[model samples]
Target: MSGAPEDLAERPVHGVRGEPFRRLLTTWTATSVADGVRAAALPLYAAVSTRDPVSVSAVAAAEVVPWLLIALPAGALVDRMRCRGTLVAAHSFRAVVTLLLVWFVHSGQTGTFVLLGCAFLLSSAETFADSATQSLLVSAAGERELERANGRFVGAETIGVEIAGPLAAAGLFAWRPELCFAVTALAFGFAAVWILRVSPEVEPVRAAERRSMAGEIRQGAVFVLSSPGLRAVVGTVGLVALLTSAVNAIAVLFVLESLGLAPSTVPTLLVCTAAGTLVASRTTAGLSTRFGGAPVMTGALLVLAGGVAALELVRLPGAAWGAYFLMGFGAGTWNVLSSANRQRLTPGPMMGRVTSAYRVFAWGLMPLGAAAAGPLAEVTSPATVIVVAALSIAVVAGFCAPVLRRSLP
Candidate 1:
């Protein structure tokens, strides 16, 4: 497919170079660097500046908990506001938060408990920016281009969030903790400027009576529930989310206890996963375009099942890392198609709510899996968790296989 038909509203995603996609990639990379700093700096800040684990944990949770708590209202706000403006404002806020941390750290006021108050404020801004930028992608790419657009965004984020970003943090943290945060502040400032340049072409909505917050929330939830395609994809992603969360929490314990490996080995195993992730991203374009998103999703789910199953019976250290990489491959595959499919199936105005609803569905069960793992491990052994998780993926894939095969992109 050289290009989509000229008459079509959205261009065909033959390759990954829509203007918005390019800029989005650039913005994500910069922001990812900032994230990398924060990821490393958080613990370092506690270790050096203060020794209270509770405060450190609270700060960490503060960064993520708001995603679940405020996602819906944030989505509605995205629907009402200019997405680019919202994103730019969000980034500017992130810069301010980091700068405030810098001031406190420099002033020797970086009390562990005190910092968390700042973190909570920061998380609120993140909630706004993340929801808005996601919504903006819908307009910039249009419907036909969603999969490719989202794939590109995810690929960039993977590098920024998963790869180079962390590496940069590790390097910077060796020097000074305050320096790491300062760098974060700088990244967000640049990102905010870049975001200001993006203006998504929002599609119009028809006149409807204003509703209460509860009604708005229900409207968003009902919209997602009513869409069969969205429901199926959301269901599959949600299942994967639970298993992934468990495995992530357990992989460390597995290596430490089951394999008799030191904690130092964990990053090497995780780093190896980039191979699988990169391979998955490279192939997604061809697979999604030729076979359609459903086929790609099914194949990816099967790979996920196989990889998770492999974790149950590994005997060698090399094989352990190999399994991690393969699992990462499956993770890459599932995320690529599923995220793209979500964007493709949803309209622009609903992107915030839909994305939030999808996030809630996928992540809501994570605590259950994370919490149950330790108890389950004590009883049935760590391998049991791996086995059951693998089996779950296999069963879900089996049920979804037929439905997926019948539906093309």
Candidate 2:
């Protein structure tokens, strides 16, 4: 107990300074190229190339489906492989795929189904790289530094996700969309070189004992389902993610029709949310240390609930500003608390599997949320749908309050 505080103080921040950190950043940037550009550009490109929402959504779903299907197995593979090799190979393959995509686009021969199929393949490789990258850091840095490592990783990845290729994609699409894919391909190649240079501190995976993949998958599923503490955390986060993804789908409708906001205001308003998330990621450590993850998470969810509820009352004048501000703050803090909670409870070796499992739930339901938003909005309007979402947040937060207040040793 006496040594605990000192141990915490010595934590190393991943992707923060040090020569090796550059490699991590470069590795991170690889994913960012595809990430920032994918949501808008991919779907929009699909529409222009072929007006098929079914095909476009399939592309989006294909990208996400791999994460749900392969992430756990990828995590297990990470535990058994050389991390650097996995990352290097993953990026190298990504580069190849992106280049092939670019060539197809340049030839004006890109098809809706072809793009969707390729998205699945690229997303599959990414699953392997992502798990290994996550597992390698804590394995190298020791358990104590997991928070700092993750914090930096989260912040850097967030920034890249927020910025990176979106700006370029927008520019290059106007000039030439094909060039944009080529640029993305180059980014992946740069990442591959960076990862190849760094050495990974590999960990042994003797527990597997060469077990069947299906058996191992069942073991992971059982572990996640059986833990009440973890379930609460994942369930709460999943709820938030699902709801927010839904909110995102209807945000333009809310801003334009309900709140009567102008087009120019959209960027400024969206930036506020991004700013809040960045601030939250930076400050998560302090909050988690003070209140512990569970309490902070509970409060974050409650705050998010209040924010959502406030959306119900957002009228003209100062009310609109305040409601949106609260929403940004709540959403931002939720990510901080959820990430901290996951890192705190999970052991280093199991971090990959647990994180994958957590994501399986948290991210898995996002499509459902997006799908639900349309019908709900059609039936009850965007504002009412969000209010219903707010109530769900409130109910879940109330249920978790007791667990949240209990301190971890």
lDDT of each: 0.75, 0.71
The model with the greatest TM-score is 1
lDDT of 2 by residue, 314-373 (tens): 565655555656676676666655565566666655655676777787788888899999
Residue 242 error for model 2, in Å? 2.9
Residue 217 lDDT (model 2): 60
Residue-pair clashes per candidate, as listed? 0, 0
Worst 10 residues of 1 by lDDT: 7-16
True-structure lDDT of candidate 2: 0.71
Model 2 ranges with Cα > 4 A deviation: 1-18, 197-200, 316-325, 407-409
- Model 1: residue 207 alpha-carbon error in angstroms: 7.6
